[model samples]
Target: MHFISHLSAVLALAPLLSLASSAGLVERADDASCILTASGGDDGPIFVDAVQRCETVVIPAETTLSIATGMNMTGLNDRNIDLRGTVKFTDNMTYWINNGFYFEFQDQIAFWMLGGNNLRLFGGGAIDGSGQVWYDAFATNDTLLRPILFTVYQASNVVIEDIKMLNGPEWINFVNEGQNILYDRINISAVSTSVNPAKNTDGWDIYRSDNVVILNSNINNGDDCVSLKPNSTNIIASYLYCNGSHGISVGSLGQYAGVYDIVENFTSTNVHMYNAENGARIKAFAGPGVGAGIVKNVSFSYFTEGNVDDPLVIDQCYMTNATECAAYPSNVYIQDVVFTNFYGTSSGNEKSVVASLACSPDGRCSDISVSNIYLEPPATYGNATYTCQNVNITGNAAYLFGDCATT
Candidate 1:
């Protein structure tokens, strides 16, 4: 009974690989334009079929599109798009044919889901990021031109579901300075092997935004599944399966002053991790008065780790340059955090994947609760450890002494 809840997560991470390939050709448009054809009617067979547009399309409610991309619908932020077409990549084999169309899209091709009042991408249509090249570049550390999702900025009321996102570039989806966004039932991946190392393909990067919900998504990448940057609040990531990556995280916050900091009100639950670096982590640098900020009201639960490096972690004084350590307090404030219903096994021979919180004494972690915890890391690995000070954390079997993630 101790390991009951976390044991179920062993089977939770199994993806529907039986499903068909969710990506395909770019569906190239003329002049890289977006084509939009909207038929006005209360409710006639509103259809959005296979069309690669070069310009924007004003798709009203109950309207459907086959499969459209590479275009921006100005003021179409809240439009409902019943993606009724097949959205799959031509093939990942084109990497061999650098002389063909794949080379053009190296710079020309990229699906831009941009500008709308209240936009919807439904009807089971797909959006492939064609991140194969991106993965390769990152693994090899060959290039530094990380791809970006900038044009799709400053839009409100967005919901993308049942859509397949295959092969994301550096940052999968970036929500910039916007609000009310939900990404549900999404399939995002960059599966890795000894030969293929998916690098830096983050699932969701919410930057300077608020009110976001990302749930029921299969995110397997080389970086954090979700990164809450500056001014991000009211964010929730649940029922997530992340594998072969860095893990779910929040931080590198306030890298530079006046970046509109303040990340609060976030919850992450029902998560399954596999072959990752750290299961759950919060890292902040030790720069000149940078890590000092107000980060509060965050909760985590139902976490199951599978063959991971560290099951839990928090590095307050993350140092990029140790020589400049005294520049800032390096003592970040973390409060009102909770972890419950935990269970899972570790990878290799390591049971030492517990909480590693290194917070500053001045303003460390407080008001935290950890209950109903169970960790059975392979039976052969080392034991987990909690490192911190003045933390009020207790409830279930989670051991602590110097744990700063408490009140």
Candidate 2:
């Protein structure tokens, strides 16, 4: 009877032993380092435990940690995540829709959010969203809420560098209400292999953030390479190579009613745009019942482009009909904006129109200057054309935009 009891005890402990072995959780002699390998199951809980317990968490090479649930590793201090392997979120739409962390802006969700102080996530690994299913699903249902791949939410003094982000469902990296953040040497690509294209895959969207820097990055995506949303200030992006993007844009702002938006002190330079829709753009909403905003002290310089549709654009009457735009006009005021050192070839999509500065009818745009711009359309499209409306143009390239209309 004692022997039988011993065998039953061992049998009861078998599952625990299997779980510990599969988790591959190793504690080093220093006690500050934790190494995690893939458990081939739901690794989200294991990852969270390591991150909460250790100061330095390392995911070794050739390991792919699968996460089925959302991770919120926020409120951490002085953490280092050395990712030498891949961290892939599972393609379970129903699970994510119910379980992913939801954000109010744009009704978006996220699979993972990392917010902390003095945190560094690097080491040249990749974060895969497994976005093929989302891409195909979004093609059928446009209203489907797709989750962002990575988000820096309410964190300060963070650096995310030398990383590869693949196949994000929507925006890849979102810096929301963060300060002193730097994204350098990052590579992002989101392309669908199916008939349904990857849509709304912006490289980086900075909202309500200050003192952010994005440098030396390559983005091949569908939407804006870098966008400064409302209340974004003191932001700089440089040395970027963007392909199939919507340019380095500012302010698709003033969309919500009774809300005030502001994007100021933004600069983008040394950008090479290829096969894009716009090279440099600023878009704001118009018509009745919309919010008011201000875009101030913004500059775009040293941009080289090829096969772009509109190399330079400023559309104040965004998403509004011409009659409504002329009737209501945009409430947003644009001031102290400069575009310089632009050399590009337009795709001739607008025939001879290479640049269009269509501001609102009122004196809403001021101190606008353009200089050293040499853009040419295709040889078959005759000469390059620059169109302007309701704004006085100043600078060496001011003559490019013929006579300004006052009425």
Candidate 3:
């Protein structure tokens, strides 16, 4: 799908819709707030009926509430969650690993799963995941499945703003099987005190979601600032400041065989990236029986990075071994990707190449263009190189990493 000539037309076809100013309230039998009594034990029971019974449910700022059990807050409509207190989750690994809601796409699990329509949750309050224990534990036990802090599953018309999330066990937020969601003015941070470090602590992972907007977010984490997982479409991520993380990524898709993944109509703009591994990346699985997928109609523009490695990257052979990748190669296809107005200094960790598009053999990637790129290696690294395999890229070579090495 070549869109070079239709650049203006394609830009005008941005799939994201403007966020609705308001979701008109409906007259319900109970228009009052259900204020829950803070409990030391599981508070899941307190919210069991509040979401269904009242139009507003309040978690007041009086006390520090602890939820020691996994919660399933779903099937709500026209509800507003007014969270004004600090809600902390207990580090009961055994119970949570066994009971958290399972998501098959990424083999992920969630601690507190929330879903509903016309639902809004906004407060200046904080939610703590107590990740130190998980970090230390996962260092020893690789089998440990850390629960995602928050998951919006099977929801629509959701707006979550002005919330503070800290120290999640894994991904901070997961938009799974949801659409028309807006997340704005939110803060997310995951830092571990131990030597293990917080591994895979992504800021947000969107899967099977569409028409979503993530704006004005400040993220300090260890993984992708925002990742579009399989079946994600029509998304916009803007005005983000990310640090100590991987950049905005399209996918590490095609992991499961006999499944087709699609991530399209995505745009990321006005992002400031600092101290990350890569500024922008798209990774897909390789080798036989891995799976098949396509990523198209994507634009990553207006990015500035400092101390980032491989500021632009696309590796279709994500986890597969080198020899196997050469022989079997990835089944996923990538096309119509544009990287524009990017300026950065490479971290110089991998000094061999500052930008890589190592796609699989047999024409799996096409219609890739880059423009207005000004990425230079740090003074310590001397110079940088651009490498490509089995792909043709079009753009201004004088601005990019020189004429790319295509083989």
Candidate 4:
């Protein structure tokens, strides 16, 4: 089905879009107040048409719209989606594997993509990914391709708030090539019901986006709470409550060869982390045949952690092995980073080591600062240990690193 082309078309002049009003189907309404319900069939086309033709679309309370196909609802203008009910994707693994929208960066795909200008999607409803089947299938086969729940692609001046996202097969939200976006009061949770856990279900992954703000959210996922991927700048994430996550991170950049990745002017503050792997991290790839990048003017502050494994970290090697990392250092240059006001306890998974700032051997890292770090190891471990390599640190807490190597 084709989307409506002209925004100048009136409600009366719009073509008749078929929406089944059967047992659970939504009744037809005007273009200004279009409401949708499930038709027990593929409601994907109907939902797509409603967003294209209507000025505002509403999914009413107690309603659940079943979507069985991938949707590309991009290039819209001044649209609004009021989701007071639920929009659930059907668990048809075979169909989605063949039809989901592909993204080339990390070889990812999305279930639905919404983008445009002056768009607002706010309602106390949910967008469910029906991910139990995907979770169980991925347990045995690691090569399964799961789709992300929601993606904001090529949009500007958007506000997505007060929404509940559930059971994503992979990532919950992805903001790609967008600008001036704000996500507020968003609650995301992806938990597996069976033996296979919800893996790689990151709360949000921002890539090539600018002026993005994520505030006042609670995320419980398996991967990074919020990750700033390549070319993400001017980003701010604050007042976040992340549990069972991989922390708010920056990069695994410089992975793809010949590509230049950059993350700058990013700040994450007022965060509370619990039972996490790493708290504030910046990771980059290093080795032969990899890309290059720079990370500068970043800050992580006012964080309170509990039982975290590595509360603070900066690893330039990233996924590269230690032997390869020493032989071929990272091409990413890191400078002017600040880590301050951290108060918490480590899980003692590494015994006494609470933080590690391991940069490459070359002059790749400079002007890194640390202060007000009060993270303690378990009682059995005695004292917290901070380790560093090939970087000069300056701050009130610089003594913790204990004679960091100067390249």
User: Pick by lDDT: which candidate is best?
Assistant: 4
Give TM-scores for every candidate, taking all chains together and pairing residue i with residue i. 0.72, 0.94, 0.89, 0.93
- Which residue runs does candidate 3 get wrong by more than 4 Å? 1-31, 398-407
lDDT tens digits by residue: candidate 1, 1-407:
01001110001112212211123212223322222333222111122222223222222233333322233343552244445443333233333123221111123222343545555555455455455665665566654344432224667777677766666555677676667777888877665444666676777877777788888888777788888766788898889999876777877665665443577998889999888887877777666756356578877889998777767766666764534543454545677777677677656433454555555444566776777766656666566555554456656644653434422
Candidate with the larger lDDT of 2 and 4 = 4
Q: What tens digits encode model 3's per-residue C-alpha lDDT throughout 1-407?
A: 21111001101112222222122112222335555545556666556556677677666687566777777888777777767887788888888899888887668888888898878877677889999999999999987899999999899888888899999999999998897888888999899898998989999999988888889999999999999889999998889999999999999899989989999999999999999998989999998889898999999999999989878989999988778888888888999999889887888888746788788878888989988877888777676677777787887743444443334
Sorting all predicted structures by TM-score, with the top scorer first, yields 2, 4, 3, 1
Model 4 agreement with the true structure over 184-254: per-residue lDDT tens digits: 99999998989888999999999998989898999988899999999998999999999999999998899
Residue 331 shift from truth in candidate 4, angstroms: 0.6
RMSD of 2: 10.0
- Against the unseen true structure, what C-alpha lDDT does each candidate score? 0.57, 0.88, 0.81, 0.89
Residue 403 miss distance in model 3 (angstroms) = 6.1
Candidate 4, clashing residue pairs? Answer: none
Candidate 3 lDDT trough over 10 residues, lowest sum: 2-11
**In candidate 2, how many Å is residue 139 off?**
0.9
Give the Cα error of residue 63 in candidate 4, in Å: 0.4
Instruction: Tell me the TM-score of model 1.
Output: 0.72
lDDT accuracy of residue 381 in candidate 4: 98
Decreasing lDDT order of the candidates: 4, 2, 3, 1
Q: How far out, in Å, is residue 66 in model 3?
A: 1.1
